[model samples]
Target: MDPMKVEVKKIDELFRLDGYLKPFEREIRRRHGVLREWISKIDQLEGGMDTFSQGYKHYGLHFQQDNSVIAREWAPGAQQVYLTGDFSK
Candidate 1:
């Protein structure tokens, strides 16, 4: 089993357990399509879902061997930004 492979199950499987869900199948499938699109976009843009989900490991503050600290934030719509901590003072 490859870690990067995603196994997708049929949407009709849910209806097997509960027939009441039959009416909502269309909406459920639409939502699922949107979700699949997002997943595909993440895979193409960020290597894969595994790498995209683990962004915290690469995006946040990190310490260097020279005792220097680096801080990083991913705020795309911010007009201004400020970082405060004991080190900031």
Candidate 2:
């Protein structure tokens, strides 16, 4: 499939933001680019938004067999994380 192209002039005209946003045009364009990239990625993801966002269900805390508890989290960028709690009564 051919990648979609974003035309800045068409967007500027459609939104009528050029006059009011001229001073910040560059920043606006950069943010628009980031949004476009995100859109493209979401569109390419299989099973759409529901499957992509189901990450929360797989992360976090849960209860397991034999009356035990489990905790989990996704923090790829973090150097370390410590889980602290008084699970004992």
Candidate 3:
């Protein structure tokens, strides 16, 4: 699979199913472009979509072999965060 080769699927089937959607086709394509840009950015910054999407496995509570609990959160906007539970106390 060549990285430069872009396989574009036509949306003609959608317009065939409903003529009303034809007017909004341009907007749909623009939105797809935005999505592609975001995907590219994530691939460059986060080492590809597979690792970026699997953040749940890293950014949450986990138990270690020593019976210790680790709590982690990614909150960029919050001024403060608190972890409360039987293990946290």
The lDDT leader among the candidates is 3
How accurate locally, in lDDT, is each candidate?
A: 0.76, 0.68, 0.78
Total clashes in model 2, counting residue pairs 3 or more apart in sequence or in different chains: 0
Clashing residue pairs found in predicted model 3: none
lDDT per residue (tens digit) for residues 6-49 in model 2: 33557567447457766666666677777777777876864666
Per-residue accuracy of model 1 over 1-89 as CA lDDT, tens digit each: 23224333665577788889888766676666677889889989889989998988878989899979788889989999998668752
Judge candidate 3 at residue 26 and give its lDDT: 71
> Each model's TM-score?
0.70, 0.56, 0.71
TM-score of 1: 0.70
What TM-score should be assigned to candidate 2? 0.56
Tens digits of per-residue lDDT for model 3, 3-74: 223333667787889999889777766666767889999999999999999999999989999988788899
Q: Name the candidate, 1 or 3, with the larger lDDT value.
A: 3
List candidate 3 segments past 4 Å from native: 1-8
Give Cα distance to truth, residue 53, candidate 2, Å.
2.2
* Residue 1, candidate 2: alpha-carbon lDDT: 15
TM-score ranking, high to low: 3, 1, 2
Steric clashes per prediction: 0, 0, 0
Each prediction's RMSD over C-alphas, in Å, is 7.3, 5.3, 6.0
